[model samples]
Target: MLYSDKAPDPVGLYPHARRVGNLLFLSGVGPRKKGSKDIPGVTLDNHGNIIAYDIEQQCHAVFENVRFILEASGARWENLVDVTVYLTNMKADFATFNKIYATYFKENQPCRTTVEVNALPTPIAIELKCIAAFEDK
Candidate 1:
């Protein structure tokens, strides 16, 4: 079944998450606010060009969005087993993103893979695709 509404409306034709048995696969989540196109920590020029952005802020917003989706599906942050991060500026943002990520995962650090990309669906600097095990094997 499709899951949504706990976070912003998706930017594409996909659900927030898909469940197969006890596992939930979350789509690539970004930092856009619910019900609007505003992205946290992003500074845009008058013509809508990106002037600046804080990776840490974007990262936190993305995680919070993921948290909402997980909670709405009866899962928690600890349930996340894996995460794939996409960044537009790995060289410039990895340290900041890592620092913020450490605060969120703490003892429940899931395996992660981060990669630099050319862009995202939106103008945000980061996005996350995650998986959670909601049931014991």
Candidate 2:
């Protein structure tokens, strides 16, 4: 199990990542900054509902969070073998998210699945679940 002080605190009681054999499985990572509840690019209404969000920003932040977990687990970005993306509004956010994703994933094109969901546990617009493979040293 890995817990990263450089990554955001998980919403629930779960480690940032777990290593088994040569594979590292990361729990869902969001756009929130480390040690904070604030989600990047998200603007919440007075009632704590999402009023607006920038998908590009969230994508970058989530990717960074994933990186933090990977580093904590002694894995690299290129080691990612699979990725699952959760989006709150596919129609509004997919294109922006894809554009940003390409910049990070153009070389290491992992198997990816993106899905639209009603919402996340928080007001963030995007989250990522990832699996990575490392050599048994």
Highest lDDT among the candidates is held by which one? Answer: 2
Candidate 1 lDDT over residue span 9-97, tens digit each: 88778889888999999988999889987899999888877899988789889999999999888889999999999999989999999
**How well does model 2 score by local distance difference test?**
0.91
- Clashing residue pairs for model 1: none
Q: What is the lDDT of residue 108 in candidate 2?
A: 97
State the lDDT at 100 in candidate 2.
Answer: 92
TM-score of each: 0.94, 0.96
TM-score between candidate 1 and the true structure: 0.94
Tens digit of lDDT per residue, candidate 2, span 6-35?
A: 998887988999999998999999989987
lDDT for each of the candidates? 0.90, 0.91
